[model samples]
Target chain A: MAEKKVIHFKIKRQNGPTGAPYWEEFKMDYAPNHNVVSALMYLREHPVNVDGKKIEPVVWDSNCMEEVCGACSMIINDVPRQACAALIDDLEQPIVLEPLTKFPLIRDLMVDRQKMFDALLKIKAWVPMDGSWDIHRHAPLIAAGEQSVRYLFSRCMTCGCCMEACPQFHQDSAFIGPAPLGQVKMHNSHPTGKYANEDRLHAIMGDGGLTDCGNAQNCVKVCPKDIPLTDAIAQLGRQTTMQWLRDMFVK
Target chain B: MADAAVDPNALGERYHFLIRRLHSLSGIVPVGVFLCVHMSVNASVLAGPARFQFAVDQIHKLANLGILKPVEVLFIFLPIAFHAYVGAWIWLTGKPEIMRYPHLDNIRYAVQRWTGIIAIVFILAHLWHVHWIIPGGTEFDAHAAAESAVNAMASLWVGPVYALGVLCAVFHFANGIWTFLITWGVTIGPGSQRRSGWVCGIIGVVLALMGLAALAKFKSMDVSALQHPPVTATGKVEPGAQTTGH
Candidate 1:
């Protein structure tokens, strides 16, 4: 008879935003091709600790089982990444899961990434063009190379991985983090969006804006979409300088 | 939405924005540029004390620059005072995770902040010894100035202190150049940053070497003659034994 193999998990569980955090260890029957999300789902069904006590099922947030949605972001094995993409087979035994530290924790492994969204609003991370009426264009001539670069910036899923790793993104500080800054680069690059470039630049020129970034460059390394965050920041830095000079001259 | 978008007052005063920009600009143009010239000029000591004194005299005797006092005050001292003030605020507030993060850029950021602090202390001490406490006062001749610098570096502790100061200042300036580019949007992408990294690294190494060489030159010279007649500005000749020999 073959021996039963089991997966071990050490999850940090919290009841609510202000709840005290505690750890619970679980052992589950080893399943083939199980990722963190699947393993978590199995734990939800079992809800038994390593001591064999039935407990409340662990809760987390996820929309897509794939890595695209960016909703299942958590600290797995001390790295901030999407739980959907973390393979149980690849991770070390006694795998650890924690909520993203930069955001407010909802429960167990779920975090509220509202700060990142709010920053997007602050930076106006969208093109000004509204679909009030359909306008025809002869050709929206964009070079392939330019499209490729734009595509890179557009892939940002607001995962908050960059924010989680950033040193400047703290509770007491007003830094808008790297995600929205990249969004600035994304929209600012668009042919139509360039019309609102001044507004975007001004948005980041104030408190907790571009100047707050300490140039740690941690955002680029942790980004799942491989967004060029540092590049965006540098570009924004230049844009803000130009904006400041222009403001001095004009206003 | 129009009010929210258009109202610049939502952020802070326009002066805060301008001051922040000035802080970055001040570091690069007047302060950084002046440090480069100052270090290169100090490197003249490698040719011998005569050459060093000659170089110092040329700077001291600039004709068009109203007086050395005004030029030093406006260009060098004022910028440094402002940079130090703003830099101190930044250094205090910055929370570094180099130990936990340990990423390459994280380490660089930590070191840059730390070096900025050390460089501030170094600059203060250098000014006190070189500019403030001259034996014949601030208007001392180039020879007297060179003699005082040599006398100061003659000590074991002071030599290493000046060396460390120079190294820290050079590192700060070099690393600062890289950040300045990124902050100012001059190096907008990773490729450009990588290239600029190489250039900044070379500049740092060269400047550090020049500074160290200047110190070594001071260390090697026999200034027993200058030490004997080391007269204070108040016409008091200091004890000869301290400066006479190594």
Candidate 2:
């Protein structure tokens, strides 16, 4: 008879927002084709520790159990990504999971990712439109290259991987992180969004805006979506320069 | 939103747009440009003291050797003061998490800030010894400068200090340039950045080598006949070679 293979799991757990964090380990009979999401589900059902003590079920956030929803993001083996994508077979032994350190902790592996969303507000990541619209003959002609670029930026799910990996971004730091910067480029290049171009540029021109980026280039590397965040930063850098010129001459 | 953007009484936020850009611009124009020229001029030491002193005299005649000169005051001193001020604020606040990320650029992110700190210290010390902490005349002759520079480099620690200082300054300038492009939006994409990276790398290596060579030659020179200079607004251009390198 073959020995029963067991999967070892070490998880960082917190009870509530004000709960003290502590470590809990669990062992499960080896299950084939289990990603982190499924494995976590199994653990939550069992809720038993390695020491044979009954414990509270491990809690996390997830939606669209594929990688698209950007939820189920946690530090697995020190890398932040969607838990649904972290396959058990590929991950190293004793898979460790922790909450992202860059945001406010809500539970064991969930966080208040509201900061990233708030950053979206800062960049005004939407096109302006009035209710009373006159009919136009055609839609705006976007170049194929520009469409491809915008598609890449549009795929950003606000996963907080970029934030988790960014040195300049954390709970306290004012750097608006790379996700919003990419959105700014996307929206600013947008024909309809171009009306708010100067407004968007002015928003980021302040203290915690573009200049705060230390240019670690880590945000691009750690982005699971592979968005060109640094490009956005550089583009905004140029846009703001133009804005400065306009402020000097036109304004 | 437009009305809310610019507040007259908002502390610090009001000029952040101009101040931040100025910080990036200041690092490049006068300060980064000066490091390049200074390194090359100092490297003339390899051609022997006569050539080295002539390079020094050319600069002294034009820019002068004084704690307070118009060209030096406006261009060199003011820019450096502002850069250091803003740079210090940036360095103190920005924390580097290289352990978690550990990417090459992440490591460089830390190195850039560090070299800034080192370069500033080195600049002040170097200026104190040779360039401008004390009052000196505009017409500091070739022999006098060669003598002063030789004796300055005569110390046991000066060579190593200069070697470290030169490398740090060059790295700071080159890296500053890379970020400056991104900061000012010159190289927007990764392909553009990679190409600029190659150019900046070459500039850094060449500048660093020039600075190191200058240090090596200056340290190996004969400083036995270090003499006081003759004070005059109209000093002789040539007064025989005062020193030679090993």
Which lDDT tens digits does candidate 2 get at residues B1-246? Answer: 553534535756678778888999999999889888888888876766656666766676664445337877788889999999999988876778888888989999999989999988988777765664443412233456666676677778788888888899999999889889989999999999989988999999999999888887767767765443332334332454233426
> How much is the TM-score of the A chain of model 2?
0.96
| lDDT (Cα, tens digit) per residue for candidate 1, span A70-167 | 99999898888999999999999899998988888888889899998888887788878657676765435678998999999888999999898888
TM-score of 2: 0.92
* Each candidate's clash count: 0, 0
Error of model 1, residue B129, in angstroms: 3.7
Q: What is the TM-score of chain A alone in each candidate?
A: 0.96, 0.96
lDDT of each: 0.82, 0.84
Clashing pairs in 2: none
Cα displacement (angstroms), candidate 1, residue A127, comes to 2.1
Per-residue lDDT, model 1, residue A219, is 89
